[model samples]
Target chain A: MAVIHTDDSGDPRLDDFRHLSTADRRPDRPGGKGLVIAEGTVVVSRLLASRYPVRALLGVERRFAELAGELAGTDVPQYVTSAETMADVVGFHLNRGILAVADRPAPLTVDDVVTGAGTIAVLEGVGDHENLGALFRNAAALGVGGVLLGPGCSDPLYRRSVRVSMGHVLRVPFGDLTDWPGGLDDLRARGFAVAAFTPRPGSVPLRELREHAPGPVALLFGAEGPGLTESALAAADHAVRIPMPAGVDSLNIATAAAVAFYELASGG
Target chain B: MAVIHTDDSGDPRLDDFRHLSTADRRPDRPGGKGLVIAEGTVVVSRLLASRYPVRALLGVERRFAELAGELAGTDVPQYVTSAETMADVVGFHLNRGILAVADRPAPLTVDDVVTGAGTIAVLEGVGDHENLGALFRNAAALGVGGVLLGPGCSDPLYRRSVRVSMGHVLRVPFGDLTDWPGGLDDLRARGFAVAAFTPRPGSVPLRELREHAPGPVALLFGAEGPGLTESALAAADHAVRIPMPAGVDSLNIATAAAVAFYELASGG
Candidate 1:
């Protein structure tokens, strides 16, 4: 590992770590670098283990010590600085104390993610970064094989998302379904049953999902309030709902997805 | 309805809504009024329906108009002001457009939450306000009868929590378990099976929980990282786990609890 000790917050070498609150937004707009950022030791460790090319790391001394074993074989530059200097460079007080940035790797294909998967998550209109990240975290813990981002979905590698996913966004294979409702047919042609989650009347209970599909399945989710559109719902092989008590509109997208993920994984 | 028109941000009637970020903190510290604050129309509406006594409201005219039906029979002062003045009084811009403050009603006992409940949630060390609120929202959506707070949990009535819960914190009954692990026994004596959620080896899988406790069940959850204490685990009738793959630690506490709540509610 190449370790460089520096006290100056203005060192151009620390540019990747600067003004992070807005820097992460650069990835989604025109002429943006689209770099994947990971925060804290746990997430940084995951980034180090991912396929993305590590650009560099910026952190304090103690965090480096904790990650020494993981850093030994890596050749990336590790910038060490004081907490105050780090705060100045980052434009916020990041108590996480460590950060890593990586260049985006080649995007995975939907076919690649689904090739050996039993259960996968496909999302539509899930623009919120934290919810997208939480869904990835839940998907990882519950053993969902892959994630296919349908239209209107946010970039899973966005900084807030990577932080919230606890860096699982780096590990989970996700590919865009750019065709919207039309693309769901691709999964069907691949012999995967598509189940869109909605609370609309006549939707089946989440518990009976296994019976409806009884094979490799794709669980489709929409954003929290607006939910799935009519065309999207019509395209799926099954419409599933986590039966809720009257008056409660719906669960947060990630929480509801976790319940469905757990149900499918447990075969309960 | 007592609709009081006031353009003055310094109006004493708006004191309950002033400097709200710090004011909410007052409830947890010494001599705090322990007031419950609700934001936006959905939450404010729920607060209006709750047993707690409403103190007053501060909002823009549009929000008041939207809530006119709910406010028709109420007599509390509604301080109408411009968005700028409302922002000045509250010390921040609250796009939620409306706010309501209520005095906490008489505290509920564990018995109150457990009574007439088919399934209940018991929490330990869940100190994060958002997590506490999310758990209550999940509990309410999934039809968990009530919530019992054990050691290390934060107050559900905290402003951030109430908002995160979408104000389900007002509707779902909750009480403190002041006796720590010992209070778990009281749940057992009442014929409610106390199943603690832990990922420890040899623990029963969450899907198997219903088989272990077919009747009334209380799903116990600990904080995300450390999990339940051994003493607390031992006190429960069953130690349950949401089965996960190797290397992943666990799900977020609220999401995990939601999975358990769905399992018990669905009887899958």
Candidate 2:
């Protein structure tokens, strides 16, 4: 490990660690070097273990000491600074106390992600970073084999999504499903039942959907309020709903997906 | 209906709606009404339908017209203000374009909440308003009869909780269990199996826990990080865990509760 103690918040060597709130948005930089940043010790450790190439780490001395085992053979520069200076450099008070930045790795193809998977989440219009991240976390926890991002979804590697997902975003395999409703046909061709989750009347309850599609399943979810679009719903082999009390709005998108994922993965 | 038009944002009649982000915290002031304020048409409608006595509403003319059916017989004041004026008074952009404030209703006793509850959620240290709200939403959706707050829990009626819950906080019954872990004994005495959810090893998986505690179960959850205190876990009749992928952290507290609540309430 190349350990470097730096006290100057504006040191040019730490340019990548500056103004993180805006750094992740630049599309014109090297390798889009607006790198994927993992905050907090837990997420930073996950980043170090992930396929993404770790560029460097900037955090407090205590945090660096905590990461000693993870950085045992790493030759990456580890900049140690005070919490206040780190906060000043990051343009926000990062209570997590540690941050690791990684270069974007090569994108995985859909086939690469689904080669040996039994269950996968296919999302549409799930633009919220936190929701997307939470979905990945649930997918990982419930044993969903992979994730396929349909149209209108945000990049899962976004920093907020990574942090909110507790870095499960790094563990779960996900790839773009560029064909929208048409791509769902590919899932069906691969012996997977495409069950779209919605609250529409006459839809089968999630319990029944699980009973019917008892094998490999691709659970399709849409944004919370608008729900799965008509084309997406019609494309699926079946429509599933979580039974809700009368007069209540549908559950949050991520929560609903978690329940569905749990049922499908757990055989309930 | 007391329909009044005010073009000026500074009108004294609008004092109740001023700087709404912080107004909800002032519970000690006269007409110091830490009134339950609902934003957006959906939540406002729920506020109108709840037991809380409606004080008044302020919104754009278009929004008022949309709520015409619900407001038809209301004798409460209705202040019509332009979007610009409403934003000025609220001290932020009011995209929902409507607001309603209601007087707090009589507090429900613990007995009032537990009287008919077969399946309930008992929260400890779940002080985050958004998590509390999401928990209520999940509870209402999954048919958890009520929520019982143990020590270190925040007020469910707080404004952020109300909003994040999509106003389900108004619908779901919740009251304090002031005695902490000891109150869990009361639940066991009432013939409700108190099942504490923890990620600790050797605990029964959630699915098995549901089957084992087949009736009148009280699902106990703790804050996200620390989980259930040893006292709370020791008091539980059964310590249950949601089976997660190896090496993954536990799910968010509210999401985990939703999954547990669904398992118990849905008879899976």
Candidate 3:
């Protein structure tokens, strides 16, 4: 375990954790894919166990003690500081007493993630980071094999998402679909049925999704309000909907996805 | 429909809409029996359509115009004011240009909500107001009969819960389950099967819940981390679990409830 006790917040070793509030870390942003940050002991432990390259960790001494088991065999700098100083450096106190930053790992190809997967989630227009995170967490819990990001989706590794996912964003395999509706063809080619979720008339109920598209299903969803576009809906093999009472608005995208994922998860 | 325009934030008529951040209206708080509040045009429309006695509404002129249809035949005062004044009175900018407050209706007994309910949700230790509200929203959408709040549950009428529920909390029937574990016996006596959701071993997979319990069901859930208590689990006719991947944590309480509700919802 590499532990360095330091009371100073300005030390350059904490550079990756600085100005995180201004996390314009998108690929198009100036810094180019800012460090993937995991907050608190549970998430930090997940990050340390992930494939991403951990640069350093910053936290109060007590949190470090909680994380000591995960720190074994690691050579990364573990900077220990007081809560106030750590808050000053991270720009927030709710970082939950521990923060670990990691360099983004090599992107997994859609095929790499889809191979041998029984159930996968494919998303489009899911721009909200927290929804994205919650979706991943549900996916992980429900045993969805992989996630394929479609158009208009935000980066799942954004700090808020990582925390919300409870670091499952680091554990669950995900990759960009890149081809839009055309890319859905690849899923079909791999013997997977593409089931798009929508509330349109003639759509089958969620429970019947398995009957419409048998094994190895790819559950497709879109952002809540706009929902699945015509192109995406047409590309799918089946249109599934969670039966809602008349007059109620459609379920939130993430919650809708959880229901679908729960239905298709093996042994459920 | 009654519409009254006023620019003054201090108008005595706008008292229900005043200092909402303080939320001094909670019955247990300094203020007695706080009015149930609904924000945003969608939730506001729901409020107008709900059974709760609408006392008054405060919003920008445009929002009132948008809600003209739902407001029809309601003699309750509809106070129109500038967005700036609305912000000041509400103590927040994100009221979505509208707010509605209704007197807390007479408390419904457990039988009132459970009557003719084919499926119901029973919550234990669900103290988070947002989770409580979201559960109601899911129940409303998924066609669950009603919510019976077990011990340790919070008042779903809290401001954040109302917004999170998109005001479905106002529409769905809910009541306190004063009997605790004994209440499970009541549900069973009413020809309803009580199924508790847990991650505990030996619990049947959720999909089997319909087969095991069949017809009417009362799904029981606990707080997120410490799930349903031992007594509650023993009280249930069957213990059901969502299938999860090895090493993954359980789903969020509300999301888990939604998945369970979706499973038991008829014709879904």
Candidate 4:
């Protein structure tokens, strides 16, 4: 691996790390290449282990040394710069001194995701990037095999989402459900029970529903306020609720999803 | 009930709601007079049901009508304002277009919180306001009777925490653990098994730990990144983990807490 030491913030070689806040906005330019950027030592290490192709790394020398084992066999360029210069190029002061950028791998297909999975999360109208990322983290922790993004879900690869998810977004497999509620039929055909989570009256409590959908299950969640639409709820094999206290609004979308994931993982 | 129509944002009567971004900072105001402000209709309804002494409400008429049932018997002044004037007083444009201010009620005692609780969440070093709030929300949803705040925990009544918790912070009972690890002893004396959550090896998986701490468990958690301190973990009866996939970092603090709370409430 080549380690280049540079003190100049304006050096053209450092352009790929320039104005990173806006770099994600444009994907056409080499510097603005829309790469999957991982910040901090933990996330950077995950990026190295992920399937995405690492382009380069920019960090203080200390962080680079911390990653010595991960970088041993890789030939990617590692740029060493002062914290001041690194902050100037990144357009903000990042407390996490190390960052790694990787090229986006080919998108996974629904079949690729569900081929060997027993449990999955299907999200609808979960537009908040933090929530989307958090759901992935929860899914990964609770043993959910994959995630299917339905309508109105944001890109999990977004920088903020990646950060909020603590880089679990890179590890969890996800694919778009382009067919709306119709795609749910595909999941049903795959020997999975679709359970839509809502707080509406007559919905089965999550604990009881788990007994019925004991096999492979797809836990469907929607955004906090406007829960799963009528069609989405109707498409599921059953509707389940977490049984919140009376007079309380629903829990945050990510929190609700976490409880559901835990319920399914614990065999409710 | 005084239903006053006010067009002027600068009216002296509306000062309680003025520049609300910084209003909570004043220490001498009601509840130290800074006013426990609730934004959005859902939170406003929660404020109405809470023991806090209501002062008045300011909102667009549509939101006022949405809160009609909650405001029925209240004699506090209701200042109806246009969305623009409402924004002017609150120091920013609030899409919810509704706000309610109330005096803080007396703090609850630790005894009050623990008296009849079957399951509770005890937190330490959880200073992040949003995390604290999220914990309370999870505690409420999962039927954790109360929360005990150990050292380094932030105030659950803080504005941002309340908002992030969707006002559940106001509903859940919480008290500070003034005696540090000693307070945990008090819980143990009350026949509650205190289980400290950690990611370290040798800690029992949460599912198995729940069986050991079967009756009236108190699940202790710490802030993200830096988990439960050595002293806090040592004070507990046993250390527990969520059985995450190997190589994955721990789940978010609130998410982990939610899973534990769910396990305890759902009879393990």
What are the per-residue Cα lDDT tens digits for candidate 3 across B1-268? 6789999988888978888887735556344657788888999989888888888899898888898888888898999989898988888785489888887778899899999999999999999987888888898989988999999998888888898998899888999998989988988999989888889889998877777877888999999999989999989999888888788878888899888888778432
lDDT of 1 by residue, A108-216 (tens): 9888899999999999999999999999999999999999998899988888899899999998899998888898999999989999999988989998888889999
Candidates ranked, most accurate by DockQ first? 1, 2, 3, 4
Model 4, docking class: medium
Question: Per-prediction DockQ, in order?
Answer: 0.93, 0.86, 0.80, 0.72
lDDT by residue for model 1 (B53-129), tens? 99999899999999999999989889888999999998999999999999888889888888999999998899999
- Per-model CA lDDT versus the true structure: 0.91, 0.88, 0.87, 0.87
**lDDT of residue A125 for candidate 3:** 93
Regions of model 2 farther than 4 Å from truth: A30-33, B30-33
Question: What is the CAPRI rating of model 1's predicted complex?
Answer: high
lDDT of 4 by residue, A64-173 (tens): 99999999988899999999999999999988998888888888999988878989999999999889988888888888899999999988888888888888889999
Instruction: Give the best candidate by DockQ.
Output: 1
- Model 3 scores what on Cα lDDT? 0.87
Off by over 4 Å in 1: A27-31, B27-33
Q: Worst lDDT window (10 residues) for model 2 chain A?
A: A24-33
Q: Report the TM-score of candidate 1, chain B only.
A: 0.97
Q: What is the TM-score of candidate 3?
A: 0.96
Q: What is the lDDT of residue B261 in candidate 2?
A: 83
